[model samples]
Target: MILKTKITLALALMVSPVMSSFATTFTKEFERSDGIHKVKIDIYEESNADTKNSKITASEYVKDKKVWSLVDYVNKCPLDINMALIKDSFEIKKINGSFDAVLFSYTIGCVGGLDPVTVKYFAYENGMKHSLRGEERMVTPDGVIDDNVKPVPDANLKNNVLLFKYMTSNWNKASTVILE
Candidate 1:
């Protein structure tokens, strides 16, 4: 389809080799505190020059103690590519006035009609630092970047309700998410 081809071309244009090395490793940290609950998060990313693959890992600590760790994601790009972490995307949100939560968002891109560098949000809760949306889950679906939908704060909205809107050159579509 025309839409698929356009997306492929857009993603291809975004590919860039960030570093020149046999293997590159980097870490980014973010910390949040509310006087009582303190949380620290570190994101580690490594890329291989030969295989053009990258792996991202995340560790979460609550009250200075490790609570959870995970392989956030892996990308196997056939060509040289870079997955840039959105540094300012880290945020803390209060869920239903109950507990504070953390959100980490990033973007990745590759060629051949993929998701096209869409923003991915991984959320974690307090205490045990368990995932608010489950392990390695993204708040947005494939092709749903920041521009596709607008988040509106509604007092009546249920905790489980997720509304998604798909915007394109041709038409706009809206739907509710049925989590798998």
Candidate 2:
């Protein structure tokens, strides 16, 4: 029994390092009302929890100068920020504050249906993150868009950045985003 236990432990240790490389975490921050907000995205190997990776991901928040009710993201490297990511729906989640009623979160599409992503923010007054506001022929990183039913943002995508910029800015004042 003692020998068997030692063997099992050895085997576990040997495989541990190999397991942690499959997960990833990505965070983006912006400002709203002069405050900072934060957005976090996590991607991992379906078979392993220890596998983690974090990189900067990008999506066109606006198309044809209009707001897309859907969320989109294209997996580039950890630094590139331009890519065409298609979207079928966006998962919206409401938090707190004045924007609570309409503010929500969601991601545009799936990682080819393998990786699921969700983005949340504040505003809208309905906490709706996936509702298509309207549809029209337009253009996006993915290509020429059709009547994509979405919302006419009372603000800009940069305004939407306020969704998480507040936190980043606050932290920066305390530590990094503003330190430099």
Candidate 3:
């Protein structure tokens, strides 16, 4: 009985790390006011609870009512590596002259500067929320990691037009899109 107990304990110790599950949740709240529009933003982050993945969700509330929400998966890593959102990189900005268009960004993964950062542009028009642009970029030792979307030369919010520069990626010279 003593030998059998020792063997069982050894096996348990060997499998403990592989069977371990760590879970965590984090939340952040802020308010943004542009003119007469008041928006309350809450960012919720959850790490590998029972879902086996980390995710970040941004909920927008107007007049204490939930209006819109966005989510990004931070993904899961090996036992030695953990993935989570970089709270410091999360930001929301008014991109247009009107209060309709807004931009938000968040960085995911363990490495600070080496992780992929995502930027999303949203517009609320005619009492509805619409996604205008969403892209991710990261610079690593090898090269630049980015979505296929062309880089904007200038965020021309004055006229609500964006000029995309693609030459840097050896694509088209330029292209224009109406952000509004």
Candidate 4:
């Protein structure tokens, strides 16, 4: 019995490292200015007792030197931002002449009995970040003309624009924003 127990303990120790290696993590890289400037997004899943949570971090490197990070930008937000609620999932909508447009969606707490998912548009250009505002729509549409439509990134530098669709406070209308 003593020998058997020792063998079982040894096997468990050997398998522990192999199992932990399967933890979820994802990374993506983008480059501009002929690969002189680079941006990397790293997503890491957190192990928690009650809920599954993940963090998305972005870093910018210029010629192998770290320049900026997403954390820095979030810290400067005007409101008391909850970094934990920011989803790990993000879309790199477009890479324009010297900018990369990114979309991050997060759920805002109930305000006036309405909880809305706000989609924010940000652009990284010339080693700086800028927020792109949605153009005011003249008339509100009746219903969702389309659902879950993915925007295609334009490769032409001349057409330096980022286009994406997002949901508004009302479920009936979906709005599209163009960032240039």
Candidate 5:
């Protein structure tokens, strides 16, 4: 409960501006051609996540059950860490139909997880945005961080992701992401 609350609070703080225009919410489902795979993603058209400016980087270490849950082949995973900007890849995938979401997957080849990742591409058919996670899904990337100490790789470590993302969860939610 605490962890979930923390995640929730942390997300609340990265607001740029409150948009009242897009209140409608919907879910879209997609299918894969490898024979059998159906993907369902909660979609909010014109979500506040789409409109915002962020210099803050938000990151979290992926480990233990958390990391394992994200990808099942956790044992052989090469990337010790992963991260993306709030509006970078994440938002672009939603805003533009240019590239399929399944193709943007960060990791590929690693196998055996709670769920096979199929989030790198998306295809719009039947009036719904649908994409399946290819073998190439990645949480972030394997990289080096020079904190001036023994540098240990960390996954899900987003940097300067947003302003409110730095503060404590309780404080973050109060930061309302603004467009300005």
Candidate 6:
């Protein structure tokens, strides 16, 4: 029994690092520029041996400086680290006359097809960052229901406010929400 235990421990130590790397894989990186600011985006895929599902993460940087690291944001938001933002799903737009007042929008892909897509907005005003509110609506074959479902799709900026429009599951109806 002692010999068996020693062998098990030895094997576990050897496999742990390899398993960890497999659990979270760094996939790719891309860059986006809006004339003034340059954003670098990185994509990662996280999985677990205990579960069959995996999640994707998007990390953003500006001018080679980290602006919104998904890992850090997830930790601060207390969101599931595995629920990652989709790649190339972010946009930065000027909100008002002041360039400092900018709006950032991104989307998080769900694990299943039926799961509602999550779109998040961030406001940068006077060098401060704030998370705007979110809204959702349900779509049905018969009609659109304002079942308090958070809207999906990308976010748009109008008069310094963030807005989103999403269609129901069946694409039969559409709804819009203003995030303040």
What is the Cα-based TM-score of model 1?
A: 0.44
Candidate 4 residue lDDT tens string, 1-180? 999999999998876643111122334466656575555655444332323334456666767887666642232222232222234434453544345554443322212321132333344445455443232121324433223533232233113333322222211222332222
Best by lDDT: 1
Best by TM-score: 1
Task: Estimate the TM-score for candidate 5.
Answer: 0.16
For candidate 3, give the lDDT: 0.40
Report how far residue 1 has shifted in candidate 5, in Å. 43
**What tens-digit string does per-residue lDDT give for candidate 5 at 58-112?**
1111121110002112122332211121122222122233322221112222223
Off by over 4 Å in 2: 1-21, 46-127, 131-180
lDDT of 3 by residue, 1-102 (tens): 999999999998776644334444444344446223343334333334233345555555566666666666544543223233333323343334344433
Ranking by TM-score: 1, 6, 3, 4, 2, 5
Q: Please provide TM-scores, in order, for all candidate models, with all chains considered together.
A: 0.44, 0.25, 0.41, 0.39, 0.16, 0.41
- Superposed Cα deviation of residue 152, candidate 3 (Å): 11
Query: How would you order the candidates by lDDT, starting with the best?
Result: 1, 3, 4, 6, 2, 5
Between candidates 1 and 6, the lDDT winner: 1
Q: Candidate 6, clashing residue pairs?
A: 135-150, 135-151, 136-149, 136-150, 136-151, 137-149, 139-168
Q: Evaluate residue 114 in candidate 6 and report its C-alpha lDDT on the 0 to 100 scale.
A: 38
Off by over 4 Å in 5: 1-73, 76-87, 92-104, 108-119, 122-129, 132-180
lDDT of 3 at 54: 53
Distance (Å) between predicted and true CA of 146, model 6? 5.8
Worst ten-residue run, lDDT, model 2? 171-180
Compared with the true structure, model 2 gives a TM-score of: 0.25
Write candidate 2's Cα lDDT for 31-80 as tens digits.
Answer: 44534444444443222333223332322121223222333333322322
lDDT of each: 0.42, 0.33, 0.40, 0.40, 0.25, 0.39
lDDT (tens digit, per residue) of candidate 1 on 1-180 = 999999998887667544433333334344555433334443434454434555556665545676556565445666644354455445566653565555554544454442334334455555433222211113354433333443332232223232111111101111222123
